[model samples]
Target: MPGFSPLELEALALSLRVALWSVLFSLPVGLFIAWLLARHEFFGKGALNAVVHLPLVLPPVVVGYLLLVLLGREGPLGQALYRLFGVSLPFTWQGAALAAAVMAFPLMVRAMRLSLENVDRRLEAAARTLGARPFDVFVTVTLPLTAPGILVGALLGFARSLGEFGATITFAANIPGETRTLPLALFSMTQTPGGETQALRLAALSVLLSLAALAVSEYTARRLRARIDG
Candidate 1:
């Protein structure tokens, strides 16, 4: 096997970092949005639902380009972030993760929304009758019941983020040891001479990671369901 350099290893680690951060940052937002969509009927709700799923239908490159415009150094939000917080997102690993998060958000929201829909409203009503606050009922009862779905959504999002390539490379420019992720590294290898073996290895790694994530998600869902039923 052709040995990888330190830079290659760094890219691999950075890829994992990007995926992890993306999952972490998006989870809460996904949950909130899922809850809103599942439990509320508000004006523009349909529009919001459509927008949430837009990334699924839009081309990945288009999503990346939009991010570049919205988060670029001179872009309004990006400029404000830079001036106010000394943060710049363009062409960075952080940008790649943001892109991944946006792309995977729909799946997360869908999974969580399904879980929310499955929750028994009667339990919430019972709690409310006992003088429990809305927030308390949500925190203690609704959230606990939806834990399995949340876990599944997170694992699914993580797997999707790990495989993100077109958008991440577009937004982050595939800088080795900085912005390049697993998929980006594999893509780079595919373009290099005599790197087919390395690309194959990276592909295998991606497959293994995906399988492991899926298995964990399934186990978590089963365990959570058993606990809820027990």
Candidate 2:
């Protein structure tokens, strides 16, 4: 507890909050994209897939800069949003969440797509043959079968968001109690004289949180697999 001072605690809490928001905001979209990539072949599908995975290949700073250019107050989308809705995304906690979500989206989509691909098509077909509507079949059969993948994707996205530094800092800046997440806090501590101890503590906390997320994901996936196999 001593290692987690008030500031450190605040950073940790903000990291969790941002990461949770990132996952929540991206999950539905990620799932739909994954389903499209896995099940449907359409024009420009390859291009769409590449765009979804672009962040994985691009540098984090590049992604952050692009977000800033497109979502900044004076940027086109930003200006339209401000003019219509008075909503601003840059340099705020919500902006940080958006950055995190963008960075983590590829991982979530990949996991869900793999899961979707692995699902037996016959099960879905059988449901359809039994007079279930397409939406009902997907909701009852496809979604349940892909739940493990979705869970794994969510955990991966959460971990990625927690560790997101470059994009969040660039797009939202390291504003204390707003966008200063755990990684940003650790980075700040590293730059300050006599802050090595705090930096190490934050580093350890980050590792613990990431490990816990992975463990939970694995456990949930295994339980789901067992249930499915049984």
Candidate 3:
């Protein structure tokens, strides 16, 4: 085990911060999108689905550029936000988190959508037959059954956020102790002269974190599934 320098530790902390915030903010929206895809039928459904998944297929840098055009200081929305609330996102940790969230959104939504689609419609129907309202049915029946998927999606999104690089760097510019998350830090190490060892250390750290996240997600999902079954 290599001793982690203070800078390395900072990168790890920043990565965790960005990943957690990204997952936290994206969770409800991802679930809503998933539900809409699974249960709704309207005009432009196909287009909606394509757009929701565009990030997965598009180059991350391209996505980052689009975000910049939409949210940069000189961009229309960004300018309006700054004028209205003085909130700026460019070259900030919040910008990094937003970039990560956008990149991870497709994975989270897809996982949740599949889970929603797989839900036994009969169970929901039975709840309705038993005088349960739609909201009540969702709370008591649909949610518990879908909890595992939610967990999986959250953890997946978190892991993806941890590894986010191109979009974050483009949007947030990788400032030390602010937006320089682990992936960005690793990129820095690789680009700097005489930093190969540090790069390897960061790479190892990333692999460990990703594996741990996956393991926890699987174990927790199984526990939730057991409780639901019993």
Candidate 4:
């Protein structure tokens, strides 16, 4: 803490904030979409799946640009929200979180879909025969069984959000203590003269944070597996 500058601390805090919000907002939607992909066949299913995973294949900058086009003040959704609800997202922390969420969503969905696919359909059918509603079966059976995957997905999304750079910087414009997360902060430091020390500190912090997230995810996954097996 002694060597870590206030700016670095702010950036780290903002990154966590953005990542937390991104994961929280995206989790339910991720689970629902994953379930749909794993359990149902519908028109445009392939297209929907492709779109959900598009961010992984597309450049981050392109994703950011698309977000800007769809969410900028003059953009359709942005304009409607502003006119009806007086809300704006561009260049704000919320926009940063949205960008991070878009980038992290595919990983979250993939993890959950795999877990859902592995769930025993017979159990669900038994629940249905026992008079459980679809929602009840999902809540009481499917969710509990797939909890590990959901946890892993959330952690993975959080980690990805923490390190998001191109999309966040593009959509949120790197405002200090607002939209400037750890990666953007490091980028800014590198551009400054004689800022290598602070940059190095931030770089190390990023690595530590990522490692911690991964460690927690692995530990949780193992515990969940053991519990399920037992």
Model 2: residues with Cα > 4 Å off, grouped in runs:
1-3
Off by over 4 Å in 4: 1-3
> Residue 141: error of model 3 in Å?
0.7
Whichever of 3 and 4 has more TM-score, that candidate is: 3
Model 3 C-alpha lDDT per residue in residues 1-230, reported as the tens digit of each score: 65889998999999999999999999999999999999999999899899989989999999899889989989998999899999999899999999999999999999999989988999999999999999999989998899998999999899999999888888889799999999899999999999999999999999999999999888999999899874
Model 1: weakest 10-residue lDDT segment is 1-10
Listed in order, each prediction's TM-score against the native is 0.95, 0.97, 0.97, 0.96
Residue 119 in model 1: lDDT: 94
Q: Quote the lDDT for 129 in model 2.
A: 91
Clashing residue pairs for model 4: none
Tens digit of per-residue lDDT, candidate 1, span 1-230: 36766756776688789989999999999999999999999999999999999999999999998888888898888899999999998788889889999999999999999999999999999999999999999999999999998998998899989989888877778888778888888888999999998888888777877888789789888988899974
Worst 10 residues of 2 by lDDT: 1-10
Give me the displacement of residue 82 in model 1, in angstroms.
1.2
